[model samples]
Target: MAATQYMTDGQGPTISMLAAGDASDMLSGYTLIEHLAQNKTAKVAQIGKLVDEQAKAHDQAQQKITDLQKEIKDLASQKKRIEALVKKYKPQSPSVGMGGVTPRMANVKTVIDQEEGPFPTIGCVRHTGDPQDHGTGHACDFMVTTGGVMATGAAKAHGDATAAYAIAHASALGIKYIIWRQRIYDLRSPGWRMMENRGGVTANHYDHVHISVF
Candidate 1:
């Protein structure tokens, strides 16, 4: 017998052919491609994260700048208010004493004499209206103050000296209506009145003489 001739041929490939195909090498290539794809995805993810971080940082910086600007504006407004308050609290000059009274009556006399001609020796200084004229002791008109020879409205017209001096000094001070109360007699007992009765109590004649200290 020919040594048990029952050997069978494999259906597909021989073991030698399978070995020649190098399965290990093909698997290595697939693995390399997969690794490369994964690396690319990781890189993309990292870039996205970096972009998001940068955007957040930019927003924070912008917000900080806006806040700083608002603070600066608020500080400026506060400074302005402080300046205004200081000005309001400032005291008046010694020239304009309390109640529109001038402390330097002598100085006023000299000024009036120099500007409006010789002042009368004895003049009347009465209030705009009358308590003496109406006899109401409480209706004190303009206040009067004296500085040597100079006289001015105090709150009640002191005597005849203050009103007389104020009226006489009006021209020098550019006083508006020296003639408003022309009926008011001077310290010298002479009456003065507005030459032209324009209207409404000669407009500029407030109760007190409108005098500027400067």
Candidate 2:
């Protein structure tokens, strides 16, 4: 037998209490409830539509994220390339020059290094200011002293005059700036009148005849 429900007050418990107890009870026995059960086919159609919309939105969001990521990667690669080029072309030092090294000087150094074989173990090579400032990167200073005798100077085993001549000759052929022995002057020497008057002699050139291959 079905269980019988008990009534407490003069009237039964109010509908509000039933609603509070279970939300579904508020719709129980209503026409809307009856239709909800009868139209399961319509509910299925609505569910399909909601699922399609959600799938489309998800696909579009994924595509946008992929495109953004690809764009970021491409930009990063370009930035790295630009930075590498800058580093590669950057001057090693300020002494290299403002516009960088001149082709003439590069060629001269190459010739000197290759053709000269080896320089003196005791002697030093002198270099002047930037080529741009001097317009010739070929300026150098070398000295040969005898036991106070200029004639004995040639007998000493410095690089032969032939080697010196080769350097000078090659510089001339290559259009490199090379100050000849005669072109040099020692303004500090006793008869340095001409060079001092012309102001062509630097202090460093006073002890050694200045040679320059610009």
Candidate 3:
């Protein structure tokens, strides 16, 4: 039998026959396998790192959503508190007998109604009054006296306080004038003015605190 040969090429087909070992070719094959294994391991490690980063990003996004929800809740609570305060302190228009009160007069009446004990009896928009703001539903009469007599003691004090409050908040309440204790305080005037004798306490406005709204 003739001796057969063996040959191999790096980039071409191989030819096999009975032959001795080729150490360089074997070493090249082993190095190629080792390189492939290393590349695979590196790729896996990179993929794991990317997955961890994605998980962290997801957690951060979820936390942000939770924080925003809490902020919305807090804002809602604050809005409720503000609304309650407005309802308690802010003036409201009267629903009943709407024809008898103007917007400004209603505001003043609301403030007076909230005053402390012994509030005066209030009357407004009387048809029998002379040609004045009362007939036009723009005036209010806070009766500080009963049966033509002037109020005394705590009643008198309450009446005084009511008048003072009205005067102090005149601009805010849109007051045109105030008459009490036989004196008149007009918004156009600088100070209280004395009136001539009207013959009686009620006639002179001493028995009532009269307020006219603009």
| Candidate achieving the largest lDDT | 3
- In model 1, the number of clashes is 25
User: What is the C-alpha lDDT profile of model 1 across 27-112, one tens digit per residue?
Assistant: 66556556756887899999999999999999999999999999999999999998666555544222212232333433443343
TM-score of every model versus the real structure: 0.35, 0.29, 0.52
Candidate 3 residue-wise lDDT, 62-161, digit = tens: 9999999999999999999987676677643232333668887988877765552233367787777363888888887787667888777876776788
What candidate 1 gets wrong by more than 4 Å, as runs, is 1-22, 96-214
- Candidate 1 local lDDT, residue 70: 97
lDDT accuracy of residue 192 in candidate 2: 18
Which tens-of-lDDT digit does each residue in 1-214 have in candidate 2?
Answer: 0111243333222333344556665555344445645576688989999999999999999999999999999999999998767655543311222133345545544344344322221112333443322443343323333122231354233334423554446535343322222342222221212322333222323223333433
Model 3 error, position 61 (Å): 48
lDDT for position 166 in model 1 = 59
Question: Lowest lDDT 10-mer window, candidate 1?
Answer: 131-140
Clashing pairs in 2: 137-214, 138-212, 138-213, 139-212, 140-211, 177-213, 177-214
